[model samples]
Target: MAMGKVPGDSEGGDEVGFAEINITPLTDIFLVLLIIFMVTSSVIVQQAPSGGAQTGLKVNLPKGGATDVTARATDMSVAILSDGRFVLGGNIVTEDELKRAFNDAQQKDPDTIVIVQADEGVPHGTVVQVMELAKGAGLGQLAIGVREPQ
Candidate 1:
């Protein structure tokens, strides 16, 4: 019996040795792959788009239609139904009440944005009227909401 090699009777004039598993090469490959994945993930994270304002001119209309305009959400959402009923955050509200709500929201933050989500069947004039109210409240960051195309 040898210290490293398995004991084999010296018969039939044949020479054979036991094979041992090595871990050093496998560990080295694993470390290299891990570093590559970490660096690639960081680069992907940095390249993603940031949360920022998007601006674009509405397309295919004479600036009066709302079909192509995009409407984004704000921290404050106001809804106007087809029946001229107004609601703020799902609660029924009168025009004066809505104005007061806007006043309160404005007092909290000057840069507060307002979103108007109205029914498509509602008259454009009605939506404009709501916009006028928002303007009077000194809320310039206005966004009109629309349903996405199916």
Candidate 2:
């Protein structure tokens, strides 16, 4: 038996045989694909629609008439949970922080609209406080976000 060639081999040569499979390139490709999938999945999760409960705040909004009030792109939403926690843009924030955010938004756009979504179980004082802060920030156009009874 020869050192590099098998007996009666068709390719007659003393060249070193490459019998091992080079999996390094395959592994690199797989890792790149995995990273792309992870980034795309995170972006999809953020853009997906939240059916109210998806936000994790669970604010039981009050029922009201189904008016044709279209939410504009410049509208800001503030949610008050039953547990007395404030949520602005899906982030839990303190009352002072919420006020500061409103003030900052108002400075950027004086006509900025704010919608307060307060749970039914939330205290009346908490709801009033949010409204007062929005108004105090010079956001003249304010609306209360409510659910229409089915």
Candidate 3:
């Protein structure tokens, strides 16, 4: 068999455009996947909620995984939900309002540790944001409340 001899070599468009690997299918699949990826990425990014209402539990997680059960949830803990709802010491606050609240909390107690308790449904990054806020407010340490793996 020759290289470009598919029924009609120079007559029809099929022979002229035909590739040995039939790249058209591959191209189509790649394009579809690209579109799917773009759409999915946007959706995933959009699903990250931003709000304020401290509902999640608060606890002083032991640093470096020590058996220090003496850690307590002082007045410096923010619990966030999947919908951006955050609760700071039983008080509801918006994401924007958290800064001032954290500042006040830090003032009251310089040794304050911001404990973050995010819902299991919340994205991992969202929880990080909560911790960052605590640090930004000049708190000593940020603690995330996590249940022992069962």
User: Among these predicted structures, which one has the highest lDDT?
Assistant: 2
| Clash total of candidate 1 | 0
Candidate order (TM-score): 2, 1, 3
Which portions of model 1 miss their true places by more than 4 Å?
Answer: 1-74
Question: Counting only residues 3 or more apart in sequence or on different chains, how many pairs clash (N, Cα, C under 3 Å) in candidate 3?
Answer: 7
Candidate 2 — what's its lDDT?
0.82
lDDT of 1 at 141: 78
Instruction: List TM-score per model, in order.
Output: 0.51, 0.54, 0.50
On the 0 to 100 scale, the lDDT of residue 145 in model 2 is: 82
C-alpha lDDT (0 to 100) for residue 119 of candidate 3: 85
**lDDT of candidate 3 vs native?**
0.73
Candidate 3 lowest-lDDT run of ten: 46-55
Q: How accurate locally is residue 145 in candidate 3, as Cα lDDT from 0 to 100? A: 79
- Model 3 pairs in collision: 51-84, 52-86, 53-85, 53-86, 53-87, 54-86, 54-87
